[model samples]
Target: MTILRRLAAAAIVIGLGMTALGLAATADWRLGLIVNFRLQLLFGFMILVAIMIAVGDRRWLVPAVAGLAINAILVGPWFGFGLGTSSGESVTVLHLNLLAANRDTAAVVELLHETDADIAFLAEATASWRRRLRLVEIPFDVVATPGDVRFGIIALSRIPVETRVLGVSTFQLPTPLLSFDLDGEPITVMSFHTTSPVNTRRDAARDEQLMALSDLVSSVDGHGVLIGDLNATPWTPGMSLIEDAGYQNSLRSSGLQPSWPAGLGPFMIPIDHAFHSEGLEVIDRRTVASSGSDHLGVEIELAVKR
Candidate 1:
């Protein structure tokens, strides 16, 4: 009992600290803790649950439950009825962060063939990926040339597509902005890949890149879809910046579908995302199977609002 109490107390304290990092410093890696806001929230609650199971100690119970309640209220908008409803025209998009290190290109190719998405956006698409995809029967593909960087982005569309490499990214690693017509409407899609905020330098770069992308997204006059491995949750400051650009998170109504660290079972984080403008409505969203990749595919179905 005493040992359990000690463990419970330590868990609570640690949980509290993690929660604090999420709330106060999600963008910064502080005290050797990376502020993965959603994960921190989740694990904090899990710790609280462990404590309850061990001792049902009211001292920690009330505050922990209260914290959970507060988080629920805060994240409510992050999980349902995103943007608005529309019946005009529907389009399905699939975004996959094909792990650059994974060699099972055949499995990835198979998954792509199975999905039959209208447009498929891929990140970390190296030359190897380019060659593999070319060998496949998929049509109308655009793969970025490996610049000074190692790998880049790729897009495969069944319809006509125009891909432009973004020139604003700090590194030559730019998210290609794609333009294509859907149901007679000119729609734009940008595939972004930001640096994972693991440390101070990386975090700063991500913040800068996010701000640039958000500003660009805000001015996009027509309907647009932004997809990619953002490397941060929707609740992060970087994501909030994008939200402020008037693009609604497509996965908001899709529930917390974990996309990264695929081997972690239920403890993974959702860093991949799709955001769209007011002219679009996210009708449905789901995560795809991990194709020997650390990240799973994020499939989003959207409709143009009439």
Candidate 2:
């Protein structure tokens, strides 16, 4: 019983601390990293409350419940929000971050063939990947930027597309901004990857890149779709900045579609995402099977709003 009490107290303290950190996420990059695990914290609090109830520990109940509520509020929007209900022309997109070290080019190629998406956006398209893809005859038109193990972005399209490569983020990685027509309407797409904010410098660079991308998205005249491994969660300032640009997160309808650290299964958090502008709405959204990459791809169908 003594041990049980100690455990309960620790849980309460840790849970409360996490809640506080998430609330103060914008204060520091490290805090923002903790905020990314809001979903995990929510689950932890839930289990904590359940244990408290079963053990008849009313003393720890109040604070534990409070922590649970705070986390619920923070992560609730990903379950569902203003989901697009537009019945207009739609296009399917597959966005993946192929791990630079993974050499299973055949599996990746097979997955791409299986999905046969209207447009496929790939990150970490290193020279090795380009060489492997070239040997095969793919059905889609491929547009790729010169990429090494550290940087690269590619787009494969079944429809006609005009693409421009933009240097983004602090490292100045190649990002593709693609333009194509969908059912007579001009639509734009940006396949981007931000620096993983593991440190202060990378965090600032990620934010700067996010702001620049948001401005670019806002400048589009008709409709736009943004997809990739953003290295930021929906609750983070990075995603909020993009949302502020008039784009809606597809996860709002798809729920918390966690797509990173592919081996973790239910323990993973969503860093990869798909967002559509005001003129376009999400018709469907889901995560694809693993292609030997640490990150699983996101499949989204977006429609032009009538």
For lDDT, the strongest prediction is 2
lDDT per residue for candidate 2 within 1-306, as digits (tens), equals 668767977988987997898788878988998888899889888988988888888989888899999999988767785556777678999998988888988888888889948999888887877778889877788875655544578788888788887766555667787898876898988888888999898888888988987887887777899899999988887778788889988888778889988989668989998988877777788899779999988999888777
Instruction: Write candidate 1's Cα lDDT for 1-306 as tens digits.
Output: 768777767766766666666677643456323345554565567667667766867777766776666666666665665544676667788889888888888788778778857888888887777778778765445544444457777877765677677665666565677787766788888888888777899888887888887887986768899898988876677778888889978767676777888888666777898989877887788889778889989888888777
Cα shift from native, residue 240, model 2 (Å): 1.0
RMSD of each: 2.7, 1.9
Q: What lDDT is obtained when candidate 2 is compared to the true structure?
A: 0.84
Candidate 1: clashing pairs of residues: none
Which residue segments of model 2 deviate by more than 4 Å? Answer: 81-87, 147-150, 169-172
